[model samples]
Target chain A: MTTGKGAATRLRIVEAAAAEIRERGANATTLDDVGRRSGTGKGQMFHYFPQGREELLLAVAVHEADRVFEGQQPYLDELTSRAAWEAWRDLIVEQYRDQGLYCPLGVLISDVGRYSPASQAVAAQLVRRWQECVRAGIEATQAAGEADPELDADRTAAAVIGAIQGGVTVLLSTGSTEHLEAGLNLCLDRLLL
Target chain B: MTTGKGAATRLRIVEAAAAEIRERGANATTLDDVGRRSGTGKGQMFHYFPQGREELLLAVAVHEADRVFEGQQPYLDELTSRAAWEAWRDLIVEQYRDQGLYCPLGVLISDVGRYSPASQAVAAQLVRRWQECVRAGIEATQAAGEADPELDADRTAAAVIGAIQGGVTVLLSTGSTEHLEAGLNLCLDRLLL
Candidate 1:
């Protein structure tokens, strides 16, 4: 949340670390590699991330989490109509399918130790944000009478998130979009009148 | 698939490894530790798993997979009635909640390299087997007019699996079964008459 040259430099390092991790994986990427890629030095890295690699990975997790949301884009924001909902679902399916077995945020979290307090906080925040978006969409559709008015938007949206996460997990292992599509379709089917 | 003393010894080794992993973690376990826990020597360990830790981990993956299925018990097999279906759902949520953030098969798969062909085969097999059970239940209920007759059982079952998986993933990160419970309820609501 800082500003100016220092903030820019910090961002550059994060971006570089993300790129390196994406290319060679988080396990293989090192501080030196990030420094070389970002054109930063040990001094600057320490100044920015005093705790070193773990801190940097968490930073990249935030970046990746942002990308996941950003990738959802306009569709995620506008789920008032059936068409928008389907489009959002399709976008999610396509993005994961394209990525196949490698999920950026997943790898970063895995490297950061998924159960660690820091990683858990970031993951929980990301999940909450994602759930809130879907909840908003559900509320919009419900108000318009496009979805079941009696439905609990927050709980239903949480279910929708679970549906996608489950489908994505299956897709990650089996390399198929069938579950992803079917799961999302089922959630929509339940919601849409 | 072998039988006799050799197979017994091999299973003993696998069980010991699984126990060790459940107690500690995959990364912290070693062949020597497994061997010691199993009351077998290096000779027996190598004889059972010539390819070493990867092979052993894959074997444990299979064991863990079996445990996942077995944990579901009579509920997984008899999901024809609404009562039975709810029971099955509760059992899943309870087991995962009890385990909390630690999913044995999940940890094993992660350690064995989730994307590797060997791990994929094991995971794919587990998913297929689980989906088949759900599919069978859907088919059974449909025949009796207890559930939606027109729903595609296979696809719906796959979606159900995705729902559980997604909920489980969220639970692993957030340590709450709310998403898992909500997701399963949605699926049941859609299916049950």
Candidate 2:
């Protein structure tokens, strides 16, 4: 990481790039647009992203992934009780319901070249972080005797995470939350006592 | 649809486009490449896909979606009993596990502009068809007294479908079948009595 002002400039560039990509798509977005949005000069953009567009895109992808995590705040961290889990699930459903389609997944999958190892790493890390939170919640529920003790927390968390991914992906395609709600409800049914 | 030799030529062009897109990404595959691969002239390509690249891509998206179903043959149709369900689930898992990442979802989401009404219609139709088969299986199992009679087969089917989607999407990111298998198993455990 760069220090002080350099780090801030780099972050500004990344944020600007993310916005440009979101609004105009990666293909349509250019370094000039990002520079204009970020108020960064051509030399500065080159200094930060030495490898140019691809490097800048990776940073934008990371930024988008962070937003996805942040979007599932509060409830995501407090999944100890069944109520909290339900809140988290409903919050997810409502977000997709209201927001139409989630873009981070789309951005990562389409714009970032999901098959590429670098982009996949960003997606994998996000999933791992997400799964870890759910796994901790499962453990907490088990300790409280709210969830079934026989269930494996890690794998089950993986299942629940998968459920959300499938649900959201389907929502993106069908513009409906039935799959998302149903998948979460079923996973919650399995988790809670 | 075109007729006789025209229909054959159109299909040949679509198949060639599908193969070209699969080999080279949508962004990289050109109309010229598709025409050359199909042994069709530029005039013929224009005659078939009057709207050009985007129109051809939509057709390619449908072709890819069809392969996704065909890949899960026989079992997909006969998902009546627990054995069949298990077989179908394993087949899905193994396909991803071996094939690395499923491309049809990628094709729809990335290649065809999943946000557009046209591409999404293809994706929605595939999901609807896929969900219908699973719903039928759930109903059949219920009738045989091997599943819960009170379950809403359609929603449950949606959940199961979501599980598969989540599992596969996660697999694409993390290169692991753990989530896919876990999600499917959890849904199956609830479905099969």
Candidate 3:
């Protein structure tokens, strides 16, 4: 049996909206723009999202949040060896580089203030989950005896996350991945040292 | 003799445009919006910026570049002691926290694709200057024996800057300083260790 056509259309709408939001910012992207980009009629969009632009934005936020983890998966989970670390780093660099300067996660999160509380909660949850994944990686690195015994896993994880964010900001500013490379190298080097 | 009225009006227009861009994003802010926000009439705005919106945007880009350095000044020049480092950290955190989620640098950089070559050049200069300051700080720390002699100043400086950018990105996403704190602590801890 095939999945429901309505669900597929809804997913398509969300994906299209995410793309628009990434290309233009939250404020610049409109429901009409999403409709045009997704090749969906206004009625269909309203049928899927009765609450209008706000609801559709929330959907996009969730989708983008999920993509954040999905895009970094497997690599984000495996930090047991130097090769694995380098692979993860390359994946990260490629992900951002391929996307150019547009940051889907940042765009979604930036509009949280204008979005409903539920939307903000979704963003918060996404961040917490992302941090937890980093925490797990740090714990695994420590367990593998690769990091300092006294290092706080949570703190180290937070720092790694921070470094990636900082590097991404620079990448966005300068359209270069040098900062991202530096961040990943520094964090891994410190861990191994 | 005082500066010419034309020059003064031009400065006012740029300052207002920068504020509007920061409060609202690049795409959301318009020439009309800048005029309204800056208390300049349409004719006056045009008189000062003959090249229209792009000219004004370039001006804002330059102003933002200056602010980035001004914001990190004094401390960015001196990171020889624990107190100095802490002061710099405080300045970094306070700068982002005070600005809330509005990233002027991000706003300018995001629109670089649509800007004049001069604007892009200004942004490039800003990053190089920012990186130089970071490099200077690391060198000072090394000279004072605060950091390991074996550590490469350029790489360490790049890492520190990257971590700060990463932290700032997270801060922008989550609207919290926890990640920023983590990045600063990690960098300092590594140096002290």
lDDT of 2 by residue, A1-193 (tens): 6899999999999999987886778878899999999999999999999989878887887777778778889888888888889899889888878865646656666666767787778778878888999999999999988999999999899999999999888877766788999999999988899
lDDT of candidate 3 over B35-97, digit per residue (tens)? 887788999988777788767777787777677777778898887877898899999889888
Poorest lDDT segment (10 consecutive residues) of candidate 2 chain A: A99-108
Q: What ranges in model 2 sit over 4 Å off?
A: none
lDDT of 2 at B105: 58
- Candidate 3 stretches with Cα past 4 Å from truth are A1-3, A22-28, A37-39, A109-119, B1-4, B36-44, B111-120
Model 2 Cα lDDT, one tens digit per residue, B1-193: 5789998999999999888876767888999999889999999999989999988987877777788789889998888888998999989988888864646656776666657787778778878888998999899889888888888999999999999998888777667788899999999988888
Each candidate's DockQ = 0.67, 0.76, 0.55
Candidate 2, residue A33: the lDDT equals: 96
Best by TM-score: 2
Pairs of colliding residues, candidate 1:
A166-B166
lDDT at position A95, candidate 2: 84
Ranking by DockQ: 2, 1, 3
Indicate whether candidate 1 or candidate 3 has the larger TM-score. Answer: 1
Better by DockQ, candidate 3 or 1: 1
lDDT of 2 at A122: 77
Candidate 2 lDDT at B125 equals 84
Q: What is the lDDT of candidate 1?
A: 0.85
Query: How high is the lDDT of residue A96 in model 3?
Result: 83
